[model samples]
Target chain A: MAIEVRVPTILRSYTGGAKVVEGSGDTLSGLIDDLDAKHNGLKGRLITPEGGLHRFVNIYLNDEDVRFLGALDAKVADGDSITILPAVAGGALGFAAAAALLGR
Target chain B: MTPGVPAVGTATPGRAKSHGNVRHVLTIDSAILDAIVAHARRDHPDEACGVVAGPAGSDLPTRLIPMDNAARSMTFYEFDSIEQLRVWREMDDNDEEPVIIYHSHTATEAYPSRTDISFAGEPGAHYLLVSTREPDSTEIRSFRIVDNVVTEEEVNIVDATVDA
Candidate 1:
């Protein structure tokens, strides 16, 4: 059995709108590379140019966050499932409009 | 009203064609809105964040899940990664989607800041903003942030009902 990867809406375009795709690898990084071979550009969205997981992306292996594990080095099994979600974040500061509103 | 997210009463279940074009006006329960405002007040001076989950493709927010701001800063708000994972999984198991992703501004108005626009990833979810800047009255607004573009939407608060 191949590893199953779940794609979130933002990155579905690379998967041809497929929510789940299959690939084979022994490690998380390898799995990503295998998937990228077919999806192309999917790796770049999940991994930064520095070869680390993107800060704005969250990858969970089964029910565990890979970040808390070994991240790219995390182990992957044939039946494992990977879920990729875009980080939900934001703020009200660090902007010219906000700074002006603050009278700064 | 946009094609994907037409005005209220025009959307049908299981017809959510696209994320960014999901909904136009937010028809929310008043009690839920009050709870969100209260959460913002309680977390004043620090940005509060949460999500409202609804049935998949329903665009109706029925479950409110308040999240811990990992940043815990007055200017920034981020969902705790672990918490986000758990909540998202729960939503997934329940076949629900994040209908409303809400956050608070301690000092600024109830609007999407440039930072907010930059980080908006859920094109289908309504971005709800609550400003607790003024202690006497709170300002709340809704917006659709898709592709770095922000469009303000109307907020229609209605009483909670058993059928809703």
Candidate 2:
């Protein structure tokens, strides 16, 4: 089955700065394996040697996180969009700007 | 408005936190965070947010401070300060802090990303992350940015309604 992988803005560097990537994978693991074969450093970042996904990454198959199902090995259907999400912290824009306004 | 942190940061010596510290944090599941992320993904990826509120006593349920995500989705979140102040003031009126400041990782997981750490600088604010790509299976971690050092901790989310 063919799936489209959506990359976050941060990891876009690995995909030649492309936001969206299309590939084929019957299962979620197959999809990632195919992606890593083409993209450098993405495999280490997404999947661990144990075959489980990295702690900071969440793999969504067709808008649903595979972890909620059975995780990395979760099966995928055709036209699935597996989104790889890197864990990010708080977005403290206003606080910083406020501090700056306060001259801190 | 950063929340999910104990005001106890400054109540002690050495333990007191400084601003911009995203490391002194506690982590929680990202299920609740997903609600916020989904909200942002639905209407405006740029500006779609909310507020969280709880009762004055323990018996009440913790509520979300859902607000308008009107700021540019450029790594950081922007809210109406007056509205935030009002929420906090109301919290003060209720005798509880918001306890969580959250935003979405539209294409990422529910962890503190570089941009999130760069922007995270609240003294007693615990950073909460919502991953849009991974719904329900989210991660929430708390942090304290003290003089540029980010300290993290784990916050057990017993129920999707309240934080521990």
Candidate 3:
């Protein structure tokens, strides 16, 4: 299953500066694992130590955000494309206050 | 969809002061600056954010795409994920890149806070800030934030007449 993965500029170092790379898997999680095997340390940037999708990293599968598609368990098929973008977020508030405001 | 500005004559690049490896200057259109300040005031109390896209590698800001601040908090701004995806794809299709990524601070100065530094992901774009704290006055500033370091840059606003 050849899935084309689009890498954002910030994460291009892991792909040897290549913008697009290929991987194989039936699910997004498996695909990432396969990608990490070839790219090395790419998974650590996408997934958190707690085993959840990083809030600051966005993954889309064929125009649908993976978060809305059962996140890591989202199914992927051959020819599907994955686009990863670092979330653009920030503010004047501190992380503690923002976290409290988020009730997390 | 954010409105597209007419393709005006290209303005000369601003004179950047050398600061080691940082180029400390952002040459922008005056009308675009006004639009940014207007958006900040309009969304006062809640932060407003947007991106200004230009030709890839041009570094000249020509398109103003105001993004929805999904967080909608007075002290924070986050581009809605889905909208961001669409906008990014649009840029890619048009052979454009984000030249300026801007946001407003309702209660603080036009400067990046710690959180802003932490979440800044675009190394190639200027991080513009607008302060709407004063009812009668607004402060606009620009910066280059890379590798967890923030360096203030001079904003050179070209008059609308010159561009038209």
Candidate 4:
């Protein structure tokens, strides 16, 4: 069975506003490649020519971080759930909050 | 997939609570943010975000705090504070300041969204943005906030990791 891919609200436009997608693969990276093949715009939006995960974009496999794992090469299984996340910043006290995150 | 898909929630809101010692400032260098932006861009098929730590004083040493990218493709990041604690220890051991929280915008420009501004927690910290809308465009920008004021800074892309 193919695993289901979920797109977050911000990236809905790339997927034609569909929050969920379907694909077949044994690893997270494989599944994304398959999806990208079907969606060129998604490929442009997601992948850089260097083949590394986008800094602004984040990926999760069953709630575990792919970066700590094997990155895009991380393996997946049937019925696995994939999610795409992008990092954003901006607010009134946004600058203060961002500073708080910076530590010593 | 929590970690499989790069989501918005995982963008580490890199904030370090004020230790109240001489009102010191925390920070992460442009090189570190460059590394993060590069990583996100490289992984554009997915989203990427994380925490970069170090110490503040006359001198600073930047450290990478590998946390969760929780936004799930929503152009945001919610870093794991628990994981951040561990990174804090590492910086403590090395005497550095964790001064930066950064994220990127795939297929968009490197500018702050309403949410990005509203979620600002730490004051005087650098807010780094990485955008990948244009293939040949330099999609990275930095910001600083204090007392509800936002200030943008020039990010220095040193090298691949340095540039990120």
Candidate 5:
């Protein structure tokens, strides 16, 4: 069985509105890469150019935060569920626009 | 509205059983409300964020913790990862939970933004927004954010101390 990855509403556009997608890999990074192969640009949004998870993006594996579980190096197996969410705080769109412009 | 969509006070499917099947109206202490407002005011222009922790299984918000917005930007807020880890660990040690996850909108009204709805990860916590847009008064509102759906709820500011 492939791992099930849950996509957040904000990033659903990249996945063609498919909430949950299946990918396979031995580790979290491998799974993300496998997903990106099918859904272009997804990995870029979740990972930084420096080869680390994006500061604003959080990836949870089976309700356990990946940060505390070795981040992208965390091991994965069949039937594991992954959840990706953007770190959000403060006001709504108005602030979001400003933050985007500020490159935050 | 969708024909079968649950109303504001109705419990959404998959809501944690510990919170019961119905959505309970959140009642916060007047002092706590004041403190949240004060924090927002103090951070004016920049959005302020924090959580009110309560005893585990109690659902009563009593401790007001004003956290630093790591982004420190007027438009965005991010809990410093290190600080978040420390606070969450402390809460676990104390057998507490973040009953209320709150933030301020320095310019917008007291409503969840699209981003807010998208980023709400705490399914069991009361998502509170305080609007400090007006100089004379602050507007505060509460909602339950589950599965990207935002449902506004009543905020009952009680006068007496919450039972421990």
Candidate 6:
């Protein structure tokens, strides 16, 4: 299945400045792997060595946060849109707090 | 909707100076601004969080909503999930959207941090930051965050009319 992914501006470098790209996978994790194959080092920026999503990265499936759904294991299908964004906050807030502020 | 402000993407580049310029201006009623400042001061040393809602797609902020800071830390703030969900649902039911998302910084300047830029999901909403570091003065700033690009904007505080 072809799933369209939206790349945030900060990570556009890995995608050669392409804002959106298509990848195939059955789960969110698989999708990342698929994209990483084409865009080297992309996965490293999103996922940590511990096999968990990086604290500073947030992945949203169809506008719903994957962390609230199933994280990297969240199911995906054709036409799904996955958005990757780094965890950012206004001022002193951290990743978790920033995510919470956005009501994710 | 703003009474005299033009909707974004509808304004012609050069013909509508007000429309073009207003895009970077956050117009808030003085009373509401004071309330937000009060909330920030009341939560001194801890971050205060809340939102201002207006008619959906209007780009006008008319309602003040003070949310509980679930994090309640001096350096961080988070809206209570359950409360956020309910508030969002209510806004949807009322055909309203969050036009302004605001929070306070207890010890820092009024600007978005890297984390804030990463977490900005609403391209149309204005992110307002209020710093309560100084006991005598509050520093407030507004910005538009789209795709992680943060652009500082001007804040125009309007006098609250009798009808308002």
- The CAPRI quality class of candidate 2 comes to incorrect
> DockQ of candidate 1?
0.50
What lDDT score goes with residue B152 in model 5? 93
- lDDT, model 6, position A22: 95
Top candidate on DockQ is 3
lDDT of candidate 3 over A2-82, digit per residue (tens): 999999887898999998999999999999999999999999989989898876678999998898899999999899999
Which consecutive 10 residues in model 1 chain B have the weakest lDDT in total?
A: B14-23
* TM-score, model 3, chain B versus true chain B: 0.85
lDDT of 4 by residue, B56-162 (tens): 54223256654556434444456653354445446557765556666667766777765576555545356667777677765767776554466676444323323
Per-residue alpha-carbon lDDT of candidate 6 for residues B81-104, written as tens digits (9 for 90 to 100) = 456656765777898878889999
DockQ computed for model 6 against the true two-chain complex using alpha carbons: 0.23
Residue A18 local lDDT, model 3? 100
TM-score, every prediction? 0.85, 0.41, 0.88, 0.44, 0.64, 0.63
Once fitted onto the true fold, the runs of candidate 3 whose alpha carbons sit more than 4 angstroms away are A99-104, B1-22, B160-164
Q: Tens digits of per-residue lDDT for model 3 on B63-147?
A: 9999999988898888888999999999999999898999999999998998888777788889999999999999999999987
lDDT of each: 0.85, 0.55, 0.86, 0.57, 0.79, 0.78
Q: Assess candidate 1 and give its lDDT.
A: 0.85
Ranking by TM-score: 3, 1, 5, 6, 4, 2
TM-score for chain A, candidates 1 onward in order: 0.87, 0.76, 0.92, 0.76, 0.84, 0.84
- Worst ten in a row by lDDT for model 6 chain B: B12-21
Q: Give per-residue lDDT, candidate 6, residue B17.
A: 33
Q: Is the docking of candidate 6 incorrect, acceptable, medium or high quality?
A: incorrect
Candidate 4 at A93: error in angstroms?
17
Candidate 5 positional error at B17, Å: 18
Candidate 5: residue B101 Cα off by (Å): 0.6
Better of 1 and 5 by TM-score: 1
Alpha carbon deviation, residue A95, candidate 3 (Å): 1.2
Name the TM-score of candidate 2: 0.41
